[model samples]
Target: MSAAQRLHQYLRDARRRRSVDLALTLLPWLAPVALLIARWQGATPAWIALLVGLCLIGAIAWRHGSRLDTPWLIRRLNALRTDMDDSADLLFAREEGLRGLQRLQQAWLRQRIETAPTTELRPAWSRRRALVSLLLAALALAAVALWPAAPTSAALDRLSPSPQIAAAPGQPRLVQQALRIDSPAYTALPPRNEPSLEGRVAEGARLRWTLRFQPQPDAVALVFHDGQRLALSRAGEDWSAQRVMTKSLLYRIEATAAPQAQTRRLYRIDVTPDRAPQLRVLEPDRGLSLMTPGQKAWPLAFEASDDYGLAGNARLRITLAQGSGENITFREQFVSVRGSGGARLKRYQHRLDLAALGFAVGDDLIVQLAVDDNRAPKPQSALSPSLILRWPADLGSEATGIEGMVKTTLPAYFRSQRQIIIDAEALIAQRRKLDGEHFLKRSDEIGVDQRLLRLRYGQFLGEEAEGEPKLPTSDSEQTPDDAHPAEAGASAKTEAHDDHDDHGHAPDAKPAVFGEEGSVLEQYGHTHDHAEAATLLDPQTRKLLKSALDEMWQSELHLRQGHPQQALPYAYKALAFIKQVQQASRIYLARVGPELPPIDETRRLSGEREGLARRGDELRAATASDPTLTALWRELEPGAGGTASASIDYAALERWLREHDERVPDPLAFAAALAALRDQPECASCRAQLRGLLWPLLNRPAASVRPRDGGDASDRRYFDALQQARP
Candidate 1:
């Protein structure tokens, strides 16, 4: 320590040693009898003054008074104390004398010091270092004591103190004042947020949403339907929701009708799962597209995502079908994102090579996408919307419809194709399950390729359920579900006298084993494996009818290729022979109807077989009770003439009319009559109506076209008169 500093400290301690403050007094050993020192600064002066005063005599004789020595002084103080104690015992007989001596000694020391020049001694800071120290101390004291004095006007009450004492020692008075204070209570929480939807979805009959989860176990997702109180358990961490069929794969989720606005399936999973497997595409909607010549292979992409705080393990099967019927598939390719992986719609691009698919102009491109997650929780499965791309460069002017797709309904096409695939699959499964008792029948759901279904009505069926005809019998007997596939063909044969004919696989039928040279059984198998009967057909008869079919197909193809006149004889021959095949098949004819035809007529042809089998049905109904028509039928003489049918055809009269009339009337109206003479002419009233009015009408005139635009175009009568004048 600095010398002056040490002196200052000593002086301060010496002063503290004499202070009467209770807190100060509690520290007894701190009292200085000017005997010695502890942690003192500037205390020598006080010690010097006290010594001089107590000297009582000049440093007597060269100050050889060793009494000034600290140790010597201590000894004298002790001796004086002993004498005083003895005197008090002998005279006053009070111990108070010695006790009072110590107290008085300290008091007297304080008084002397004050009289000299007392200094404030802080318990912390040493006092009286110099003028600077004193000023600092004063300023500190002022700031504390006078700090914005909380206005004492409305003052604190003074306590009367202990009755035994004049004042309370340690406390300061109180007062009332308002001070600015902080509020540590009310608080507002922020609103919740989520990621937004990023893109568009294709229009299709069904939309499906698959939830993907992470594997290593994080949390679990709890999904609720629109307003179901409890969520239905789905596959794994995965769940599926289907729309009628869903409109688009992409649907933005807004506020859900849940207690909290935050709605999501919560799943507990980790970033990675050790044994996660690729999601099974077999879960649903898995099949290859039916490729047409020059058709493209499908190109696909998928979105697989996971909950926050976990990794989304997506396995996308991206495939491309180019023009040459070649297919490129990217399967089980892993796509991963960590922690609340995002679900923003991102276009994962793929291009199918035109040459690869063997596709030419006017050919369709079929693209497919299969997606799934390979995480621990139930993996998610998704089939992206199939895209039909038009290779405009190749299609040229021929590009139209779904291929060129100028105004094609893509969603419809996809739905239809998928449905056909689904149905075909269902038939195979059903056939694999059941035996020969079931087969195909005509129904509303048949597709456009009627002839493609078969030469007659179907693939085939092993069993026939045509029970013996009864003489109008009893009360109530519903027709049994026809067991024979040819029930359809049988009706057509009898009708075509016009055509019927058509199910699916018979599980016990052993697939009608065949070599691939030219699969008659396979073709039949497909027919049975379609919706023609919805699952009831035999395979053998389907094979036998194949040759006849080739002929018919070639004829139809030529006809379609603007060679209808060349196809005329073939169409007629096929019709008659196909009918014979159907009739001989033992009602075995059956078929899986096409998915849907491009035209209504195509649908009906495939479904009912030939031109309206229902026509003869209408004819029968027309003559059943009408006397005039019935009489005509009876008198006309039927081909296989008999009273059983109670009908006939006036073959001679029809011939005479055809020879005499230079021109026949609307030929279709006289169809039955002409066929009866040239084919099967009958004399029912409707037939007479045709011969009587239609043929003569045809000789009258040709229908006329209307005037162009607005000029000379307003006269309906003029057009009609012109039409009448054509003949």
Candidate 2:
């Protein structure tokens, strides 16, 4: 390449270097500026600014380089590149006389440019300046990143249009006002004061306003948005008003003087409603619990929390499902929960005995803690999720199919009792080594296990009692209690049918013949009625088992109260009772019946359908006998608007009902009225008819029948009478 081409390249290279150095110098400044812009206008604007800054820096550097043409390059070369003594300019001259000189000078210039060190020729960067700028920028970035988030209120206020406050000229102006907020004692919060009129307070807090006008007004009153004005009593030169804040409200202070009326800024009272007490089951940690073999009582540990305080309105609800399959019966009850601590926080614990809850061996117990707060008007309650405790069916027997090789005669839970004893002994041995709290916790845990085992055995007895069938016999004939686990095992093994079952009888046994196995009373008996044959424990045995469970409960309570030493004696006694009861022979008596006759070779097993129609007529005739229920039932039907067989004086009934709307004498009558009203509320005439019908119920006394026996004989009679009396 020629000298000019080389020099041009050199100058171009120098320009690029200068641009880079200038960019480096401006880069540090650019970053912070971009970041600052980003803070206000977002990343897009910051990026735009950075791009503009880099372009400007590049343009300036390019302009400087563009100025350095061949002549300027010669000058810069002499000044910074080589020691040409300013003669390097001659190398680019194109004058006619200087052509030869130019050629000779070109050679010298080419040599000088070629040999010139690139470092000196290239643009120099302000290293210290750039370094210092970078350091400052890094510090700035760190500060920005580490800066705390600004208050939202301050930011919003800055952006919002300020409202101009108009002050009355030469009037008694309001100067200072303070709102003293005193929360309710239940909240247990100290009184607080806010300089501004607007403030938030807990519900039921008392807010006292102290206002001082420039010149004390003759009268001052607090005006609420609801138009209720409360006059402030005078205290020295200031005016004050105290009002309990039951709900959120907006109010302003109005001061009246001789010439003008002054009003303070409008303020809003923010009232926070007290939340309902919250219940959290801490121990079980889950909504479902499975009692391993031998567990008797549930050790419930829970927390009750409220913003204010618990109103001591907390209870443990227990629901027990009795029986099995489709015949299951449900019973519910509420028991008091212990440990009602203060409003902020309270830990409660209660050990519930399955026996006490009326839970049977295979029954499921659903328990939940319900808590209410001390809110006025209407208190709020919160119920924890239900915790289910189920005593699963014995694993030994099968309801159907072939039996397994190993027949577990004793229920699985029986072994659980032995495990409990082992656990209790282990806990006792470790009690001395453990700290008081740990020791007590361990002891209580073992006590809970003991209670559970005791209840397990107790349920065996309870089930027998519930399952025992009542037989007609003399008082001298002892009524055996079916409350034996061994008997339960037998029933389980036999897969015994329900009391209502026909026991392989023909399907024609619609009205099942109830009788003991083969007594002469079989024709008039319903002994096969499983209801009659239900199992029960002997009364004496039942009482003993109940006492044993009670002792176990005492042991648990004592252990939970942190007295392991005191609980041991009761625990031992309960165990001893359990053993005694286990040792007792609970012989279940099987009823004997005559052997069946040989079946006829030519007969089929088909049932006789002959007498069904007559039997149904008899059943209907029996049902028609109850006149009151039949009349009530007829009146409740929508189609029976005026089909009453008996005369009812509508005018007199309407007048009576109007005079005595609350005095419905019959429970069924009240139900009928409600049903009629619900059936056709919009029909005025129908409503009047229902009201007329209600008068009879209001005038008539409640009807009740004492069942001759515990069976459905009384119900059958009542239904038959009702059917016969139907219009």
TM-score for all models, in order of appearance: 0.15, 0.31
Taking all chains together, the TM-score of candidate 2 against the true structure is: 0.31
Stretches of candidate 2 exceeding 4 Å from the true structure = 1-170, 233-236, 257-264, 311-313, 325-327, 340-343, 355-358, 374-379, 394-727
lDDT of 2: 0.63
lDDT of 2 by residue, 26-107 (tens): 6776766777777666789999998999888788767765665566666677787445767877667665657675677767
Q: How many collisions per candidate?
A: 100, 47
Candidate 1: C-alpha RMSD after superposition: 41.4
- Relative to the true structure, candidate 1 reaches a TM of 0.15
For each candidate in the order shown, give its overall lDDT on alpha carbons.
0.35, 0.63
Writing each residue's lDDT as its tens digit, candidate 1 over 1-727 gives 4323533454445344333232222222223323232112236855674555444223332232222333332333334444233222222123355566666554443343334332333223323343454466455545544443332212211111211212233321111111111111111111111111112221122223333322212222333221113222246544334432121111222122321212321211111122222222221243433334564444433333322111233323323333432443322222232212233222343444456545555344544444444322344455545445444443223344466534333232233222433443454456546543342321112221223333233334322222223223441132335523333433323211111143222222335446663356544544333456533424554544554565556554653343334544554555555566667757654788878746666465465566544535532222233343334443443333334223444444344444543443332224333333332233354345443543233222335555576446558768878889998
Please identify model 1 stretches exceeding 4 Å from their true place.
1-286, 290-298, 305-313, 317-341, 344-349, 352-581, 587-727
Best-matching candidate per lDDT: 2
Candidate number with greatest TM-score: 2
